[model samples]
Structures are given as C-alpha cells and as structure tokens.
Target: MLSLPRSRSLLAAAAIVATVATAGSLTYSLGLGLTPCELCWYQRILMYPLVAVLAYAYYTADTGIYRLVLPFCVGGAALAAYQSYLQVVAGGTCTFGGCAAVYIRPVTIPNQSLIAFCLIGLCTLGLAVRTRRDRT
Candidate 1:
C-alpha cells in the first residue's frame, strides 16, 4: 500500500473530510434544490477552506499546518454544535430561514452538521498527536 507519513496522513484525512463535506453541501443545494440557511452558509464558509488548507498542507508535508487548521475546525464544530442544538431544542427554525435534510427520516439531524462534528474530531486528532519532532 502507498502510505503517507503520519503528519501527511492526518492532513489527508482532514482534506478528505472537508472535500466530502463541501461536495455534499453543494449537492444538497444544487442537485436536490435544498437551500442553505444563513447559519449553514456560515458553516460552509468555514468548511470550504479546510479542503484547500488540508490538501495543500498534506501535499507540502507541512508539519505546522495542523495548528493553523485548528481555528477553522473549532469554528465549524461550534456551528455544528449550535445547529444541532437548534435542531433539537428549537426545531431548526432560523430567523433568516430554516434548515432541512435531504433524507427522509432515518436520522432526525442535519447531515452537514454531523459532518462538521466528524471534521471536528479529525482536527482534534490532528492537533493532539505530535506529527513532528522538536528541534533541539
């Protein structure tokens, strides 16, 4: 198997997640004709860049990129969490508009928010592990 080094692998994972997330959101809006609300747009803004950031970091094998990516991840996570909260407590009723899912009801939550949660986990892992060594 062609395997990347640890740091690159982490970046690759994050990149994959962000890519999938961006594609899914785009599909929801463009293919299914589902519109994204203001909060969803905010989360999208945070997510789309992660795809580029992680991909470039992985390609360059930039060990320092994980920390740089943390802010976006954390922001996405917060938005996802708040979105989830709104779904549960407030019934996803946005002041600007409302949010909806593509699927019928196997799951009652928004899939994009779930992706954000997963992205949050991947980013946390990226930051928690020491993908590089300190120069003495």
Candidate 2:
C-alpha cells in the first residue's frame, strides 16, 4: 500500500515535471530562438494546467482528481510524441517563420520535445501506479 508521503512524493514529481515543462516553454519563447508550432502550442496548453491540478490534488489529499488529470497528461504526451516524430523522424521543414525558421533546421531532431513528454508521462504513470498499489 502506498503511504500518504509516497503519494505526495509522486504528486510532487508530477508538479516538478509540470514546472520544468512550463519553464522550457517560456525559455523557448524568450531565450531560445524558436516559435511553437500549432501542435506544440496545444501540448503546452495541456502541460501548463497540470502543475496547478497536481498541486491542488496533493494539497487536498484527493487522489480522485487523477481521473481528470491523467487524461490531460496522456493527451499532452500523445501530441508531443506526434510532434517529435514529425520533427525528428519525418524531417519536415518548419515554415512558421520568426525564430522557428532560423532555429529548427530540417536536420534537427525534436529530442527535447520527446524528453518533455516522457517526463510528464513517467511522472503521471508513477502516480497512477502508486495509487493502484495503495488500493490493492
């Protein structure tokens, strides 16, 4: 069974992932010379809220919210995975203009996006597994 501390720890990890993802987006928007594609923007939308939702769930000690939050994380992961494939495997040209045009070369792999998705998925999955283990 998962202890309260353990559940909290899982939530904390999710929160950290959310925070890092948010920071990464801001960094890309500000420091890094790259504009987000439509899919990237959608992924960001999903990621940004996770920080608040997970924190809220942890603070309230309500695991029930996972039903709501997990789907968002999953959706974000799927979108990120698709974007990564398009950027890394497909090797398509980014014609969005602005900094994106300069930064994302046709040859550049979207490993960073994939990493972000993996982090989010791993954290969320950890929480779900811990919750299930606690139940059993």
Candidate 3:
C-alpha cells in the first residue's frame, strides 16, 4: 500500500511517452521507410528534451523544474496533435510535404506518438496543478 509521489508518477509517464516516441520513430524509419520532415524534426527536438527534464525534476523533487518543463511538453503535444489530425483525420492535406506524403497514401497517422505526448503533457499539468494546490 505504498503511495507513489506525484513527481514520480509524472516522471514515469514522461519516460513512457519518450519510449513510445522513440519506438515509433524507429518503426517509421526501419519498417515504413518514411523520412521525417523539418516540422517533424522540430517536434522531436522539443519532445526529446522532456524525457531528460522530467527525469531530472523527479530525481530532484523539484516541482519548479516540472513547472518549467510542462510548457515544453504542452507545446510538443500541440504540435503532435495537429500533425496527427492532419495526417489521420484530414487525410494528409496539410501543407507540410512530409506529413502529406507519408500519411496521405494509406491514411497512416502517428496516433501513438500523438497520444503519448498529449498524455505526458496532461499528466504533468495535473501534477503541477496538484503541487501548486498543496503549496497554497
């Protein structure tokens, strides 16, 4: 009956998201043979940092660092959500060539990556909110 701390939960969630994202990228590169575009690269740049940041925050028990990291997670999530919609729902009509080309043909979307990132953001946000409530 041991209760885990919020920071630990958030860190675990971020790690899971990072793991899934890495796997998806590998799958696309090795299995689907799809190359990522500039926007996709940018999204990855923003996302990869969260794994480290959240891990550090959890290790240090620094809710303040978590607060800072949350914005980046949210931004990455927003980008991923938009890309997923464009690729899956919109049928790859997005202006980005990589998104349209890779996703348009089979209507394939990186839904797992999108969901993982969004969940990371949401869980971190929830943790941050709860932390703030406890402090106040």
Candidate 4:
C-alpha cells in the first residue's frame, strides 16, 4: 500500500490528465472552431467537473476521492467508446451529424477522450482498491 501522500499524488496526476483532456477538447471547439458532436458533449460534461473536483480533493488530501471520480470517469469512457464506435462503424454518422477520427495522423477526439477516461478510471479504481485494502 502506498502512503497517504503518495496516493494523493496519484490522484493529482489523474486530475492533471483530466484537465488536459478538457483543455484539448475545449480548444478544438473554441480555438479551432470545430464543432463537437453529441458524444463529444457527453464526454466534455463528464471531463470538465473532474478537473475541479479532483483538484480540490487532491489538495484536501481526501482519501476517499475515488468515490467521487468513479462515476464520471465510467460515464465519460462509455460516451467516448460509443463515439469511437460511431467513427469506425457508422463512418461519421453520429446523431449530431458526424465525428472525426483522423486529424492529421489517425488520432481523433473520441479516441483521445477514451484514452483519458480509461487512464483516470483505472487510476481511481486503483485508489479505491488500495483504500479498501488499507481499511481491512
């Protein structure tokens, strides 16, 4: 088991990842003028709050912050996964028009969001598991 400070550091790292994802998506929309699709909006909704909440929890050294982050990360991952599926299978036939899967190379917003959601979700799960272990 990691020390409390080490656990908090991991949470802070998760917060950072979430914040970067939020910034990237916001930049794609606002800075580049590329409108987002429904799944994108869903992912953003889940990603945005984590930046604030996780940061606060990290600073407060909240050992149980995983409880707060799990739901959002899971929902975000689901939306991202769905978006990714639409990109691959539907081939840009998303409900809100379409989604892009290749921007420059072969990385798209949906894919990026999925990666971020997975990372954060797993991190939170690790924290939850470790916390439970400590309690026992």
Candidate 5:
C-alpha cells in the first residue's frame, strides 16, 4: 500500500469533496431536472472551481494553496448556511427556484453543500496546520 504525506493527502481529500459536491450538484440540476435557486447557484459558483483548484494544488504539492482555497470554502459555507436558514428558519424566498425545496427528505441541497464545503475547509485547515508544524 502506498501512503501519501499528510499535506498531500489532505489536499486529495479536499479535492475529492469538491469533486463529489460538484458532481452531485450537477446531477441534481442537469440529470434530475431540479432547478437551482439563486442561493444554490451562488454555492455552486464557490464549489465548482474547488475541484480543479484542489486537484491542481495536489498535483503540484502546493500546500500554500490553502490561502487561495479557504476563502472559497468559507464563502460557500456562508451561502449554504444562509440558504439553510432561509429554508428552515426564515421561510425566505429566492428569485429562481424554491429555497425550501427538499428532494432528499430531511437533507436539503444547501445542507448537503454545507457539509461538503465544511469538510473541504477542514481538510485544507488540517493541511495548513501540518505544513506549519513541519516548517517549524
């Protein structure tokens, strides 16, 4: 079995999360014929590029890429969290589709996106910590 360095492994994990989130969103909108709301679109904007960004960072073994990626993760997380708030708390309305729409019963799309963004953020933070510790 081949084991990767912690930093590289964390980048790979983040890349995987981004890929799955991107794929799942695409599946929901394109395949399942579910229309995305405005907030969903914003979350997608933040999430879709992470697939390439994290993958390229992993390919180049650039641990410092966290500086670039973390903002996007944070933005995505904020958007997802807000959407969740709208759906669950505020009973808000979106310009595009319905923010309150829930296809997976208990778990809304924004909630799932939130999980993915948070996971990617955590992995990136872990890599940052590991890189810093290694440097000192």
Candidate 6:
C-alpha cells in the first residue's frame, strides 16, 4: 500500500518539476531573449502557479491539492498538445514568436511545456490514487 509520506514525496517531486519548468520558461524569455507566443503565455499562466500549489501540498501533506492542480494540468496539457500539433503536424502559425519555432532542437517550447505538465499531472494523479487506495 502507498503511504502518505510516499504520496507526499510524489507531490514534492512534482513541485520540483514545476520549479524547474518555470525556471526554464523564464530562462527562455528573460535570459535567452526568446519571446513567448500567445499559447506559450497561456501555458505559463497555468504552469507558474503549480510551483506554489505543489510546494504547499508537499509542506502541508495536503493530498487534496490534486483537485486544484489537475484542472490546470488538463488545461495546460491541452493547449500544449494543440500548439505542438500546430508546430509539428498541422503547420499552424502564430503572429508572435512563431509557434513552429524549435528553440530546444527536436522539441518545441510547447512540447517541452507539455512534457512538464504531463509529469506534474501524473504525479498529482498518482498522489490522488495512492491516497484513495490507502484509505480503502
């Protein structure tokens, strides 16, 4: 059975991932001189808060934070996935920053964002499932 501490550990890991992702995004924009597109900004809006929310969850051992985090995850993931489709598959374009621009080589910013959101979302989901399973 998954223990609370283990579940909380997952949240902590999620927090760490969020922190790194947020930092990476900032580095791209503020440090590397890469401007974000509209979609990127939306992903950032959803992602930036997870650092705080997941950190709080880790500190308080508040497993319920998943309720708040998952929605953001879903939204961010959806946007990232769509943007990725635009950049890689559908060949869509954005007025700002060029949605198809591949800054990281092989993966676009939206793809990177998608990966981060998915990781955090999986952690949050794991925390939720393990907590529930333990209760039963």
Q: Model 6, stretches more than 4 Å misplaced?
A: 90-96
lDDT of each: 0.68, 0.67, 0.67, 0.83, 0.85, 0.87
Clashing pairs in 1: none
Q: Model 5, 1-136: lDDT tens per residue?
A: 1124777889999999999999998998899888888889889899999999999999988888989999999999999888887776645444357844654666878889999999999999988777777777
In the range 9-107, model 4's lDDT, one tens digit per residue, is 778889999889988888888987888877788788899999998899888878698988999998989988887788778775565645554462457
Best by TM-score: 6
Worst 10 residues of 2 by lDDT: 95-104
Error of 1 at 98 (Å): 2.0
In model 5, the clashing pairs are none
lDDT for model 6, on a 0 to 1 scale?
Answer: 0.87
lDDT tens string, model 2, 1-136?
5578877877787778778878877887777756677777777788788888888987987666677777886787786566555544444444332222233343232345556657766766777777788788
Candidate 1 on 1-136: residue-level lDDT in tens? 2224765666777788788888878977798777887878888888888888878877887766767677777777787677766676765454434664334356422555566557655764654465533321
Deviation in angstroms for 2 in model 1? 18
**Candidate 1 least-lDDT 10 residues:** 127-136
TM, every model? 0.80, 0.77, 0.74, 0.91, 0.90, 0.91
Q: Give the per-residue Cα lDDT of candidate 2 at 54.
A: 80
**Residue 17's C-alpha lDDT in candidate 1?**
79
* Model 5, global lDDT: 0.85
Model 1 scores a C-alpha lDDT of 0.68
lDDT of 1 at 62: 73
Which residue ranges in model 3 land beyond 4 Å of their true spot?
1-4, 30-32, 88-90, 99-107
Model 6, span 1-136: residue lDDT tens: 5577788889989999999999999998899888888889999999999999999888888888889999999999999988887776556454456844755876778888999999999999998888788879
